[model samples]
Target chain A: MLTSGIILLEGGLLNPNPGLIFWTAISFFIVMLILSKFAWGPIVSMLEEREKGIQSAIDRAHSAKDEAEAILKKNKELLARADSEADRLIREGREYADKVRTELTEKAQQESQKMIAAAKDEIEQEKRRALDVLRNEVADMAVKGAEKIIRTALDAEKQKAVVDEMIRELAASRN
Target chain B: MRVKAISRILALVVPVLLSLNSHVFAVTAQAEAPVKESATAAAPAGPATVAAPEGVAPAEATATHEAEGAEKPGEVIMHHILDNKVYPIEPFGEIHLPEIAAKPFGIDISVTKHVVMVWLACAVLLVVGLTVGASFKSLSSKESPKGMANAIEALIDFIRTDVAKSNIGHGYEKFVPFLVTVFFFILICNLIGLIPYGATATGNINVTLTLALFTFVITQAAAFKAQGVKGYLQHLTAGTHWSLWIIMVPIEIIGQFTKPFALTIRLFANMTAGHIIIYSLIFIAFILKSYVVAMAVSVPFAIFIYLLELFVAFLQAFVFTMLSALFIGLATAHEGHDDHAVEGAHH
Candidate 1:
C-alpha cells in the first residue's frame, strides 16, 4: 500500500505521457469546432420558434372570443326591439277594427226605418181613391130609381102637376 | 418490467462474458504469451502475504527458477487500468502499436493504446455530432428529433442548460461548444473502457490532465477578459489587506490551478480506481486458486462493481464538465452578483 502511492508518484501511472496529451488536445479541438457549429445552434432556435408560435396562437384565440361576445350582445338588442314593435302593431289593428264595426251598425238601422215610412204613405193614398169610387156609384143608383117612380106617377097627370108645383116651392125655400 | 430489464442486461452481458472466456482460452493456446504469464505470476501472491519492499523480488525469482505458466493479478490489473504500447484484439490476440520516437522539444510523442482510444472517441463524437447536425438541417422548426437523435439531443440539452448556463450564467453561449465536446468525449471514453477488452482513455492521468489543462487555460483567459488586466491582477491579492499580499498572492495563484487539478484527479482516479477494484475482485479467485470463490465471490462482486462503474462513467463526465463551467463562472462573475449576496447573507 505504501509503495503503491510511491509507485504512482514516481514512475508508473502518474508518469507524464506527452503523446497521449497531444492526441487528446487535437481530437478535443476538432470535436469542439464541428459540434458547436452544427448540432446545438439549430436545435435552440427551433425551440424558440415553437414558443413564439404558441404565444401568437393564444393571442388570436382571446381576440376571437371577445369578437364573438360582442356579436351576441348586438343580436340580443335587435331581438328585444323587434318584440316591442310587434306588440305596438297588434294594438293599433285592434282599435281600427272596433271603429269600423260601430259605423256599419248605425248606417244599417237608419236605412230600415226610412223604408217603413215610405210604405205607410202609399197605403193612405190608395184608401182615399177607393172611397171616392164607392160614393159616385151610389149616387148614380139613387137617381135611376127616382126616374122610374116619376114615370108611374105622371099617369095621374092633373093630380101630379099640383104636387110638383108644391115640391118646387119647398125645394126653393130649402136652397 | 424488472424481469425484462434484468434480462436485457443479461442479454448484453452474457455474450460479452462468453466471448471473453473464449478469448482467454484462445490466448492460453498462443506461443509467447504463456511464458510472459509465467514470468509475472508470482506478483498476486505478494499482495496478501509479502511487504511492498520485497514485491519485485518474487517476480524476478519466479521468472528465473519457477518457469510455470502462472499469471500475476497485480500486473494484469495494472495493465488493464494503465496505458500501454499494445492494443489487445479479440480472437487474434493482440497488435503491437507503432512507436514513433519523435522527441519534439525533447518529449517523446509516441503513440500508445490510450492515444488510439482517444482517436476512437473523437471518431465517435464526430459521427454522432455530424449526424445530429444533418438531422437538424432537415427538421423544420415545428418538428422534433427522433430515436438516437432524440437521446443525443437530451444529453446535449442537459449540458447546455444545467451544466453550462446554470453555472456560467451570462455569456455562457461562448463556452457551450467546448463544454459539450468535453462532456461527450469524456463520457464516450469512460464507457468504452467498460466494454470487454477496451481501453479507457480517461483512465490515463496524462489524458485527464490534458483535458484539465484546457479548462485551466480557458478559466484564466476568461478571468482576464471579464475582469481587465488591473482587475485580474487585483484578484490575485484575493481582496486581502496590503500586509497579507505576500501570503495571499501565492495562495491565490495556487487556488487558480487547484480547480483544474481537482477535475483532473477526480476523473482519472475515478475511472482508474473502478477498473482496479473490478480486476482486484476477479483476481481474488485466482489468488485463492479456488472454483467456489470464483463462482460465489469473485464473479458476482465483480459484476456489481462493473455496473457501478457504468454509473460512475456518466458521473465523472458530468463532474468534470460541471467544475469546468463553475470555474469559468467564478472567473467571470461580477462583484455584486448573487454569489456575493448569498455570501453576505450567510455572514
Candidate 2:
C-alpha cells in the first residue's frame, strides 16, 4: 500500500501539467486552423461539386423520362384517334353503298315503266293506222258491192257509220 | 479460417515465449537498474524532473521483481498504464525526453513520452492533411479519388455528414473542419499507442482535459451565440417554478461543466484501462512464473486484450467526436424545444 501510494505520488500521470496542456492547446489550435482553411475548405467544395453534378444528372434523367413518357402517351392517343376515324369512314362507306344501290333500283323501275308506256303508245298508233286502212278498204268493198247492186257511190258520214258497225261486229265475233 | 487458426496457435505459443522473455528481461532489468541509477547520480546537474532520479529506478526494478513473485501485480499494471519521461522504442533503446521548466508555477512542465507522441500525431496529421488537400486540388473532376485521398474522403464524409451535420443541424457546415480535425487527431493519437514503443497521448488526463476544454469552450460559445444573454440566462432556469430555482439553477450550471468533464474522464479512462488490462493479462504470466500457465492462458488472454485495445482506440475516438458534436447541437438548438417541454409538463 505504501509503495503504491508513493508510485501514485511520484508518477505525475493523473496530474494535469500546465506546459503540456499549453503545448497541446497550441498544437490543436494550429491543426484546427490550418486544416480548416486549407484541407477542409477545398475537399468540402469538391464534395459539394460532385453532389451537384449527381443531382443535375438525376434531374436530366427525370426530365428525359418524363418527355419519353409524354411522347408515348401522344402516340397512343394518335393511334386511338386513327382507330376511331377508320371505323367512322368504314361505316360511312357502307351507308353510301346502300343509298347508291337503292337509288339505282328505284331509277331502273321508273325507266322500265316509261319504256312500257312508250311501247304501248307506239302500238296504239300502229293499230289506228291499220284500222283506218281497213275501214277504207271495207268501205270500198261495200261501195263496190253496192255499185254492183245499184251502181252508185255512198256519202262520207254513211261510210263511217258503216265501218264502225262492221268493226264492232268483228270485235264481238273474235271475243 | 487461416487467421483464426494462426491466432489460436499464437494463443497457445505466445504466453510461454512472453513469460520466458519477461523472466530474461527481469534479470537484465535487475542488473541494469543499478547502472542507470549510478549514471543519473553522476549527472546531478540534469533537470530534476527531466531525468528521472536514480532513487526511483531501483524501487521500480524491485517492484517488478515483486510483481514477478505475485506480490504486487497491480503496481506493475499501473506503471504500464501511466506516462513516463522515457519511451521504450522496441528492439531499440529508449528515447528520454528533455524536461523543459521542471516546476514553473508549481506545475511539472516536463516533456513526457505522451507529449512526444502527441507531437508525432500532430506531424502525421499535417503531412496527411496537406497531401490529401493537394490531391483534391490537382485531381480533375472526372477522376474518382484514389489512394490516400480516397481513404481520407471516406473519413471526411462520415464525420461531416453522419456526425456533424446530423447533430449540429442547419449551420453544421461551419463546424465540419474543426470536427474532422478533432476526430482524426484523436484517432491517430489513439492508434499510436498500439504500436511498439509508442505512447497513448489521449490516455493522459492532462491531454484529454485540454481537448475537452476546447470542446467545452466551443459549445458554450455556440450556446451564447444562439441564445444571447437573456435567452441563455433563461435556459439555465430549466423552466421550473421560481420556488425551485434555488435547486434547479445550480444543477443546470453544473450540468454544463459536467458534460466536458464526462468527455475528459471517458476518453482518459478508456485509453488507460485498455492498456492496464493488456498489461495485467501479460503480467499474469510473470505472476505465475509457469511456462504451461503462460502458454495456455495469459498469453492468449493478453493477445485478445491487445486486439480489444485496438478496437477501443477507434471507438473512443469516434465517441469523443460524436459527443462533442452532440453537445454543440444541444447548445445551438432552437427554442421550440422549450415549448415541447412545457407541453410535456402539462401531461
Looking at every candidate separately, what fraction of the true A–B Cα contacts under 8 Å does it contain?
Answer: 0.64, 0.61
Question: Which candidate wins on TM-score?
Answer: 2
Chain B fold agreement for model 1, TM-score: 0.80
Task: List clashing residue pairs in candidate 2.
Answer: none
- Superposed on all Cα atoms, the candidates' RMSDs to the truth, in angstroms, are 12.5, 7.8
The digit string of per-residue lDDT tens for model 2 on B112-163 reads 7777888999999999998999999997777899999999999999998999
**Candidate 2: tens digits of C-alpha lDDT, residues A17-90:** 77778778889999889988778888988888888899999999999999999999999999999999999999
Write candidate 1's Cα lDDT for B82-123 as tens digits. 677767664555677897766777766777889988998988
Overall lDDT per candidate, in order of appearance: 0.73, 0.75
- How many clashes does the backbone of model 2 have? 0
**Which runs of model 1 end up more than 4 angstroms from their true locations?**
A2-11, A47-175, B1-68, B336-347
Rate residue B232 of model 1 by lDDT: 90
